[model samples]
Target: MGYLYIFGTILFTVYGQLILKWRIEKYGSLPPLVKDKILFLLQLLVDPLILSGFLSAFVASIFWMGAMTKFDISYAYPFMSLSFVLVFILSVFLFQEPVTLYKVIGLSFIVVGIMITSQSV
Candidate 1:
């Protein structure tokens, strides 16, 4: 059940990130002027998809709080790094983002770190 809470946090985190990126891409880049940029962001704020993204973040935080009660921070925080690995792979496929060797190496390290830390549990 504790692991489930952590998993929920990871899923919500990933969903929030991906949804925001997808929606923002559709909205295009920020405007050049400061006022225009403010207006542009305000436009996104009302978007249902963007709102959902924000909600997902809130949900993720709740899940993280639950996780906090279930395990030591040292034992659980490493799992959060999995979000980075997931987002990296996901962005490559969903956004056609490039996968550099350095990124692959970094992700490998994250996975290894998680594996090592999970042993403490």
Candidate 2:
């Protein structure tokens, strides 16, 4: 059950991150230092794609938090790092983004990290 939670968290978290990336591509970044409510509202309303992405991401976050509560951070957090690999794969097909050798190497590292962390737990 703990493992299930961990996997679920990783899945949702990756999906959420991909959604966020899509949102960013659709709408410009919102700087933390900025305090303009009017501009924020305009951005929110003007970009439907960004809005959908935001909504999906918000839903995924709830699942992620629940998973965190059910598992150890040291074990679960490392597993979540696999999301980097997942997101890379997702972006390649979903968004037609380029995948390079460096990304493949990074994904290999993530897999190795997951294996090591699982053994530790």
Candidate 3:
């Protein structure tokens, strides 16, 4: 059950990121960093998809808090990296993004590191 919470945290985090990326891309480029940044952020606030992504991030935090109650941060924090691996795979499938060899190698390392760290618990 504790592990499940960790997985929920990862999934929600990844989903939030992916949705934000997709919606932002659909909306086109943001204003320059030095100009009207507050207005740019305000635009995102009114976007339904971006708003949902923010909600997902909130849920992910809740799941993260629940996981922390059950496991040490060392054990749980490594699992958060799984969201990177998940988002990479999902982007390739959903957005027809390229999957490079380096990405594959890096993702494998992340998985291996998580596995090795989990053994300490």
Clashes of 3: 0
Model 3, residue 62: distance off in Å is: 0.7
**Model 1 / residue 64 / CA error / Å:** 0.9
Q: Between the candidate structures 1 and 3, which one is better when assessed by TM-score? A: 1
Identify the candidate with maximal TM-score.
1
Tell how far residue 16 is off in model 1, in angstroms. 0.2
Position 20, candidate 1: lDDT: 97
> lDDT tens digits, residues 5-94, model 1?
999999999999999999999989999999999999999999999999999999999999999999999999999999999999999999
> Model 2: which residue pairs collide?
none
**lDDT of each candidate versus the true structure:** 0.96, 0.73, 0.90
Candidate 3, 1-121: lDDT as tens digits: 9988998899889999999989888867777875677787788889998999999999999999999999999879998999989999999998899999999999999999989998954
All candidates in order of lDDT, best leading = 1, 3, 2
**Model 1 stretches astray by more than 4 angstroms:** none
lDDT of 2: 0.73
Measured with C-alpha atoms, the lDDT of residue 85 in candidate 3 is: 92
Best by lDDT: 1
The segments of candidate 3 whose C-alpha lies over 4 angstroms from its true place after superposition are 32-38
